[model samples]
Target chain A: MSEAIQPRMIDFKPHEIPLEDFDISQRELWSEDLKMAYFERLREEAPVHYCKDSEFGPYWSVTRYADIMEVDSNWQDFSSEPAITIIDPEEDFPLPMFIAMDPPKHDDQRKTVQGSVAPANLKNLESTIRGRVQTVLDELPVGEEFDWVDRVSIELTTQMLATLFDFPFEDRRKLTRWSDVATGGPETGVVETEEQRREELMECLAYFTRLWQERQEQGLSNDFISMLAHGEATKDMSPEEYLGNLILLIVGGNDTTRNSMTGGVLALNENPGEYAKLRNNPGVIPNMVSEIIRWQTPLAHMRRIANRDYELGGQTIKQGDKVIMWYLSGNRDERAIENPNEFIIDRKRARQHLSFGFGPHRCMGNRLAELQLRILWEEIQKRFHMVEVVGEVERVPSNFVHGYTKMPVVLHPL
Target chain B: MPKITYIEHNGTQHEVDAEVGVSVMQAAIDNLVPGIDADCGGECSCATCHVMVKEDWVAKTGSPEEGEESMLDLNPERQGNSRLSCQITVTEELDGLIVDLPEFQF
Candidate 1:
């Protein structure tokens, strides 16, 4: 077992310490307000800040827009192999998914399932997505406050995930459960022990293994599972590899868009003028979709292992050092974006943001994600005057998934 | 609607009508033109929508901006006439525009 590393002891309280001294990796700093403040300070004072120790151990942070782009694009120096999270991979139960892989293999395996999210596929899925979005919105209780994250965001994204894998419709929430377990920590209350998390993920692997067999027997199909079962590169994956890739797709298809869905509501409610502007000009929905992604930054950071010693943004990143690219911070980088703090729906060049990442390993389902958001907002404009934020918002506790856990909202119909 | 021709690297040609104000990338997407990935959904973050503006139309299409150029720089196959379609807004003057999609975009 890898020895559990303890966080470096800090003598001063977080709020009492000056903002410039903040460690961006501290989970407590991830709360919306505190995190934003910390990012603001980093972009101004230290774009490439190094932490001697974190829960994940010593790492360098690329906090500014251009610096992150440099790190993300130069995969030769900063590789994605082994892992992409702050925590090291579980040595006992290593799951080798393509998102954490380097080129050649990563390119091949990613291409295997890339067909499912092609623009052509998105065109076919658009009506189905719209139908589902309308159904969820229509079923929403007007004038009563409810957790939008659960009712709207989770439900809609789960349904889309079910469609992707063609998993049993009734047991679709299993996908959601496994996804949460995959990214969850002990503090999140999703799983108390590593063994428990492993057990649940193994259950997930078993379920998909059955589906894999069924799909192979049925020959080729358009679903993601069938694509993997039939693809030249992925047909013979080991059980662990299969589980790794499945978790990637599930979490990729789920959390990013799901969180963005919730974040869209939160951003709009917080910026009433933007919401009113949206209502007045529904033509901006497509552009606003990109802006929402920028503002939301669903996945907070993607860690890259340095393949060799490298110099970037006035700092040296030694070989094998874990480097974190904070997408949330870069998305708010004033140098890269004008008025980075404000949520402007109609901003020019709205798509120019770091939320989807860049280079070879950028988010595979980016267009589909945008399609879902665009359709949801399109339907929203036709019905609701405003989706009022009615109660306190609870953000996900983890630093990795920058998402809302619960947000009470009431829809005011047009 | 202005008609634009997109030639795939494989020599397959698709002629589609592009709405003014919408992007040429959007026009290709609307027409289901195969090669233009537009993976970032017109973000200009990904150069998946790279197209080589035909020789005759190079002057009309203009050049890629700094952001688009940086994205295109990552594409080894980028040409002198290469433009990120997302950055090029469709307009009446580009009615008969011809853009060749590189094989890599597929």
Candidate 2:
């Protein structure tokens, strides 16, 4: 009989980071080069590893894809009530949204906002989304180098989401800024102090409150806010719940999609041959979109509270414990994916990646995000012959979102 | 075979002959109905195949399961008659059934 490999505690605390300054690139979030190194180590050593006495308090980092899916699917055992992120929610943090709620209530509230992200709704917006993608691509500096992250990816996604919500296009940047402050811990970029984040949160709440009030009074049926304002869920939602959900929708829509765009561009540039494959056969765009999301694995991890004591991957998790589902690691699992390290555009079953998550909490904006990405790739193919990396890509200094802050790309028009 | 009619939110109605064993969602997809994508392949997870049973046929179609009912809450134009079409099998009794596609199903 084969003996079980003796479990060994990997000393990762020598690399422990503050909750605020937890940038993945510093450790490994910057580019695929850095990430692959760390992922390989994690997979080899402790796939379901635990870390103690670090930032965000003591927690388990569930790395393997199968482990993440097991934890995510068994939500009853792995609760979402305590904290949704690695960092414990401060006293001033906004009330929990549906994503943080458990069954029954979570089921009800989630449904209220589901329609806005449903595939049918997304199909209707395809043309407008395509137009927005084209608009962003058209505005790109023809011969000069530009930060695709800011000028192209973020702007294009922000606009698409804004239009879907019927948000005032002029002030849409506020959504991006708030999402950054809300999710941006001290790791990379601007780390908002607790007080500053609270102030920003309150300010955003005030703006949303006014918008909700106006929508209620006007009784318009054109946007998501209006639908939420007059929906069945409104009967039960407190002002805090309403605002918390609005914030979740905006953040959920913004950061992840934005990161996917930036990640896609970086992936293609890094894999020029794959880029050539995509350019040569535009028919591969759909699969390419799946591969990008799989390869990038944006939204690194989602935290879930253990509702009851449960065992996973031979590890015992007590009730009320925290489990971090590392989607980034899962997407690269050697067992689940063939050539998991390589970015193959036509990898069969690439769409099965856990980036958008799986089961009940799967991303509601999946279709819209895919539509925008498809159009963006289509437009880029039409306009540019090659996108050469001109400068260093700046990565967001956080583990939660795998994204680029700046990617200087020289667009060569066809 | 049962005849099913799907009237989109935009008022486009598609009539098709459906076998009793298949689901209304399967029937819609088979006929290339525009709105129902059924991304999850009728698992009731995607909620892409949401449809509002015509008022007269509401009782005949029966209430949705807990999963489908929960999913309907997320539908934008969720009416009292909302049901995940994937969950509703097209039995002989449901012939001439009418379902309205919601304007939005994310």
Candidate 3:
């Protein structure tokens, strides 16, 4: 971690902070869920705002919905290479995942593995997902408070990740640990040091490397490892490349819907009217799923590098400057979404939201994520009157993963 | 007004009066047709609005532009006749056009 001094973003109100000092990258703001007001101010004042200095150094923030659409879609001007988060990826230990690579290279590698999670395969996986969801939900004790984030959210998504990888069912939690460790570091408490973070990631690479070797001997298969091992394009991927892609897949498949699962329960409990809307008409589950994903906006922002100087929102982003497209902020931008702050389940054009990001590099596992959430909610509706939020909910103390660490909830059976 | 028929994968046909110059996607959303998610709200960037034009209507609808083709390239289920409904503008030439909605969007 950079030894740069921490900015006490929470001490200053959103409006009180000077525009130049508006560093939304601060962990305190996201941990406390205090970043929204700051983003609202930025979208209102400076849609293409820049912070001259921060712990991660200087960068620009694109907060408006349409501006994000422009930056995200134009990978030509806004490069995704190097990294896709606010902090620059660790040097010396580079992870060359496709999400961070530009076109041609990005498209080639993503094409090889995207098939495993695309709509065609998702159709086959639906029954398996629903069955696991049933088992996970059925196993939970009703009327007793439990950590929904762990018991339901983590378990369900983790199981889905395992199924997608055809990973060892007994050792599935390792996937969760690796996913957490990949995105987190000493500050978030996943690992005590940056060196340890890299060590665990290498361990992740070794394990997957073994899986790759084991699966390479077998015939072509449906799981990600088998597909990659057998894929014409990915067969000879470097260890770093394999690990980078694995982290991308594991975290991509795990954290997103995991947070959405917990977020939906809290969203419903917070907005009882929406819960009632759900109970009255279960048919709205699909639409509600989109709304929930939008509401959570799980991965808060995607970072990009300006390939060339470009003008957006009347501000000129110079080439080589790091840029952060705040999807969380864009989702709440009033200009695009109607009544952006409210959680309306039946909201029209819910899928048009920025949570998926737009353009070629848009999320590869979006369909799987949606299917998982939709089925999970469908199962929840049939089993319980409410997954009531019964205790203090702890938010993840990081900007990238907008999620809950612990959400105490007690299911009231119908 | 052009009568564009959106045939779902299951053979359910929804024939709606598509307004002149309106995209085929907007007509379905207006008519509350079951298929065609149109997630990007008429931007050809998202391939979710994919639809297969019938052989008879292919000439009238035309081929996808570079942007549309690039997006469709990412979709595994994309067929030779696949065109994003959001990119297909409803016009007099397409009066009797019929397109088949795929089983699911990418």
For all candidates in order, the CA lDDT equals 0.85, 0.75, 0.90
True contacts kept of 2: 0.34
Candidate that scores best on lDDT: 3
Interface RMSD of each: 6.5, 4.0, 0.9
Worst 10 residues of 3 chain A by lDDT: A1-10
Q: Compared with the true structure, what per-residue lDDT tens digits does model 1 show for residues A126-187?
A: 89999999999999999888999999899999999999999999999998899999998565
Residue A9, model 1: Cα distance from true site in angstroms: 12
RMSD in Å for all candidates: 6.6, 7.5, 1.6
Tens digit of per-residue lDDT, candidate 2, span A275-391: 888878999998889889888777888999887778877778878777788888888889777889899997775666788775567787787778778888888899989877889
For candidate 2, write residues B29-102 as lDDT tens digits: 88888787675556666566888899999999999876676556555567788888989999999999999987
- Deviation of model 2 at A60, angstroms: 1.4
TM-score of chain B of each: 0.95, 0.94, 0.97
Docking model 1 quality class = incorrect
Candidate 2 residue-wise lDDT at A36: 55
Maximum-DockQ candidate = 3
True contacts kept of each: 0.09, 0.34, 0.60
